[model samples]
Target: MTHRRRPNDRLRTLLKEADWTQEALARAVNTLGAEIGCPLRYDRTAVAHWLSGTRPRHPVPQLAAEALSRRIGRPVTPEAAGFPVPWREPAGEDPVTGFAALCRSDAETGSRLVLQQRPYRVADARAPSPPALPEIPAQRPAADRDPASPGPPQAGAGGPELAALHDAARFFAASIDTHGGRHARSALSTYLADDVTPLLTAPRPSPSRREMLGAAARLAFLLGRMYEDGQLHGLAQRYYTYAHRLASEGGDRATWSLVIRAMSAQAQRLGHLSSALQMGDAAARAAQGLAPSQQSYVQAQFAVILAQTGERRGALSALATAERAAEHAACGQGGSPFDTYPRAALLFQTSQVLEALGDLPGAIGALRRSAAERAEADVRGRTLTHARFGQMLLRTGRLDEACAAWRRFLSGRERLRSGDAERALREMRRALRPYRNRRCAAELLALSVPLTEHS
Candidate 1:
C-alpha cells in the first residue's frame, strides 16, 4: 500500500549543489544500492519519477543520500538529498518547521471533524480501537569511513586536545535535552564531520590518544542520540556503530557496554526483538564486575529486551538484580549515572517492559518513577514520559487522570519538538474519538487543538 509521494524542491536544490545531472544521480543511487546488495536498477526515468513525487522505498533514499554525501564531501541526509516526507517546510529559518510543515494536516483534520457547530457523536462500544504503534524500520549499521579518505577538513586531531570536543558534545547534548534536536542536531553533526573527525585521525601521544579516543566515543554516542532524537534511524544506527567500534578499539569497556545497551534499546524500539536480546546479553556480559550502577544499568536493559523476547522469568530476575545493584550504587558507591546511564533510565525501560508483559498497574508505577527520575535538564523527556503515561491511562479507561497527565505534556511547549510527540498526540486523539462527548475528552481535544494549529 505505498501511496504516491509528492515531488519536492529539495532534490533540485541538492542537484544544483552537487552539480550532478539527473542521470548521473540516478546512476549513483543504483551503484550505491548495488554496493548494499539492494539492486535498484534506476535510471533517468526513475529520477524523473522521484522528481515527480514518486518517493522511493526506505533504504533507496538512504543510499541516494550517501551517494550525494560522498560526492559533496559532507553528510547529506535523505531530507537534504531531496526526499523529505512531503511535509513541506514554510520558507526561511522557521524554527518550528515540523509544526509548519503539518499545518495543512491540522487544518484537514479540523475540517474532517464536520460537526464543529453541532453536537458531536459520543463514545460507542464498537468505536474503532486505537491504532497500534507502527513498525519502525530496523536501522542497518553502516560501514565506517575508509581510513584513507581525509574527511572534509584536514584530518589532524590530538588526544588531549579533544577535551574541548568532549565538552562541546556535553554542552550540546544538554541543549538538545532542553531545546529539542531540530536545530542542534545539524550543528553537532557538522562539528563532528568538520572539526572532530580530522582531529581524531591526527597523531598523538599514548595518553593523549586514549583521551582522544574517549572523547571521540562520547561525541559519536551523542551524535547518535541527536540522530535518534531527530528520528533518523538509519543515520543513528550508523553513528552508534561508529561509537561502538571506537569504544571497543580504545578499550573503553564501560563505554562499550553502555553503547551495547543503547543499541539494544534502539533495536527493541524498532522491533528487532532477537537482535535486541543478543545485544543486551553482550552488554550484560561486558559489564560483569563493573560498578554496580553500570552493571545495574546494563541488567535493566537486559530485563526489557528479555521481556520483549518473551523471557518472562529471566526478565523479572534481571530486574530484581538491577534493583539491588541500583540501591547499592545509590549508597555512596562507584556508580555515577554520568559515567554510565541515569539510574532512573532503567525505570523508564522497565515501565515499557512491564507494559509489554500486560501488567497495567505495574507499568503505571514504573512510569511514575521514570518521570520523577528525569533530570531537570531533560525537559522534553519529562514531557514525553507524561504524554506516554496519559496515553496509557486513556487506554486503560482513566479519562480524567489521563487528561491530567496530558496537561503536563501540553505545558512543555518549548521543549516538545520531536515529531514523535506529535504522533503520540494524534494517537491520543484517536483514543479519545469514541469518548468525544465526555468532558475530559473535550478538554484534551481543546488543549491539543492549539498545539497542531499553532505549534
Candidate 2:
C-alpha cells in the first residue's frame, strides 16, 4: 500500500518569495537542464507533483533548487526545498565498490551528478573514514564483472597497464592545467569506469597490485581536481576520499598526503576554517618523510590555513619551512605531476597567506611573482592568477590596473572551460559596478559582457 504524501511547504514558500508561477519554475529548471546537456520536458504539472511531495529523480530536485537560487539571488539548497540531498556517498560502503559506483554515475550522467550539488558543510565532514580495505582479492569470473568493469584483463597485466595509466594521468593533468577541468572530464570519467576498474579487480602479484592501486589513486586525484575546478566541492571531496583510501592501501603516503592537502584546500575555499585547519595539519603530518618538494607543497598549504586562523607565528614558521624545502628541491625531476611542486604554486600559496593576514600590497607582490613564474603553457593557471591579481588590485583602489589584469584573464579564459574562471568573471562584473562610469570600468565591462552572457 502507498503512503499518503504531505505538501512541500518549503518549495511553496520559495516559489511565493520569488513570485514565480509553477510554469515559470518548471521552465527555469528545464532551461538549466538543457544548458548542462541534460535536456528535459518538465512542465507545470511536474512542478505541481513536486509540490505535492512526489520527489523527482536524480537531478530535478537539484535543478529546481538551482533555478530558485538564481531567481532569489542566494543559495537554494535541495534540503531548503524539502528535497533530500542528491548523490550523497552511501554510509559504510566498501571503498572500492563505492568508488566504482561513483565513477559509473559520473560517466553515465556527465556533470549532472555534480552540477547542482553544494559543497558539503563542515558538520558533514566529521564522518569517520572508511575502514582499511582488505588485501587485493583474487580476480572474479568474467560473468561477475560489473557494468563499470571491463570484460576481462588485457594480455599485459602489470607493467603495461600501469604505464598507460601513468601516461593518461599526465596527459589529463596537462590538459586540465592548459584547458581547465571541463576539458575531457567526461572522457576521463568514462575511462576510469570502463577501463581502470578492471585492472583494479584483476588478479595480480602483491607488488603489482600495490602499484596498480597507486596509479589508480593518482587518476582519482586528477578526477577530483576536475570536479574541484567545476566548483562541485562535495563531489570532489568524495573523489578525494576514495583517492586517499587507494593511496593508503597502495602504501603511497605521498599520494595520500596530496589528497589530504587537496581536501584541506577545498575546505578552506568553502570557508570552513576549523575543518580546513584540521585537515591541513593532518596533511602536513602525512607529508613527513616525503621529498623536499612534496613537503614544501604540504607545508605551504598548512601555512595558508594558519594565516586564515590568525596564527601569524605558526604561519610564518610554516612558510619558512616550505621555503627551505623548495630551495632544496631539484627542478626537472621526472615523476608523477603530484610529486613536483612548482615555484608558481608555492608563491600562489604565499599570496593567499599574505592576503589572509591583511597585507594587500604584499599579497599583490606575491601574486605577481606567481603569475610571472607560471609556465607559459599553463593557460588555466595563468588565467586564474590574473583573475586573482585583478581582484587584489581592485581591493587596493587600482582600478586601471585591475581592469588591465582582468583583460588578461579574459584573454586566457577564452580557451578555458573552468567554473572558477566563470565565477571570476561574475565577480569582476560586481566589483566594477560601482565604477561603471569610469573609462576603465566601462571599457572592461563592454569587453566582458559578451563573454559572460550565457554564464
State each candidate's clash count.
Answer: 8, 0
Off by over 4 Å in 1: 1-160, 331-337, 453-455
Task: Quote each prediction's TM-score.
Answer: 0.65, 0.78
lDDT of each: 0.64, 0.79
Task: Report the number of the highest-lDDT candidate.
Answer: 2
**Candidate 1: pairs in clash:** 5-53, 6-53, 7-53, 123-434, 155-198, 156-198, 156-199, 157-199
Candidate 2, position 390, lDDT: 94
**Model 1 agreement with the true structure over 89-135: per-residue lDDT tens digits:** 13342212222222222235442122111110011001111112122
What is the RMSD, in Å, between candidate 1 and the native fold over all Cα? Answer: 16.2
Model 1 scores a TM of 0.65
Q: What's the TM for model 2?
A: 0.78
> Candidate 2: where are CA atoms >4 Å away?
1-4, 7-89, 110-157
Listed per candidate, the RMSD to the true structure in angstroms reads 16.2, 8.8
